[model samples]
Target: MQKVTLYTKLNCHLCQDVYMMLMELTLETPLEIDLVDITHAHNSHIRAKYTDRIPVLARPQSEVELEWPFTMADIRAFLSDPAPDS
Candidate 1:
């Protein structure tokens, strides 16, 4: 299974749109998602790193990150990309 982490903040329209897209995608794609609100997170590192990019999707274990302004086709390609170690 693929692991996805979402960096988001409240009241961010882009973040909401990305979230909706991911949710809609789950209907046809099988992947687990973790939503993290970086704005108020206890870990300042994450907040600092993603404040400008609210809607970031990352595969932590693989160190792969996908920023916003992405289409469904982009997401599909991201998921299909081979893992770094593979």
Candidate 2:
């Protein structure tokens, strides 16, 4: 299974769209999604970094990230690539 983190914010249509894509992809792919709301005060640093890049999909413990405007094919490609050793 692939473990990933999705950085997002509330009321973001783009984020919602990505979430739906992830959910649909889960049906065929073994994915573990960790939804992180950058809006929370606890995630201030993350919020600052992703304020303009909501709905970013990233591999856990890896720097690889797929930003918004990505398609299902892109997601599949991203997941197909193995995460680099940390």
Candidate 3:
């Protein structure tokens, strides 16, 4: 299974869309999804890191992130390609 982290905030349509896409991907792939709410974090660190770019999908170990406005193809590519150092 791959570790997929989603950095997002409340009332974000793009975040919701990414969540939906992650759910769909779960049905076809083995992904351990971790949803992080930027608002809940202290000092707005997460918010600052991903303020303009909510719904950021990151592979922690690999430090790979897939930003918003991505299609299913983009996700598929991410999944198809394994982490560099899982």
lDDT of each: 0.84, 0.87, 0.84
Query: What tens-digit string does per-residue lDDT give for candidate 3 at 1-86?
Result: 77788988899988989889889988987889899898887866677998888878888678788988798889878767766836
- Report clash pairs, candidate 3: none
Reference-based TM-score of each model: 0.89, 0.91, 0.86
Shift of residue 50 alpha carbon in model 2, Å: 0.3
Candidate 2 C-alpha lDDT tens digits along 1-86: 78878898889998899889999999997889899999883857898989988789998888899998899899899988876725
Model 2 ranges with Cα > 4 A deviation: none
Residue 9 of model 1 has an lDDT of 90
lDDT of 1 by residue, 21-82 (tens): 88888998788889999977999999999999868988867778999889888888887788
* TM match of model 2 to true structure: 0.91
Poorest lDDT segment (10 consecutive residues) of candidate 2: 77-86
Best by TM-score: 2
Q: How does model 1 fare in lDDT?
A: 0.84
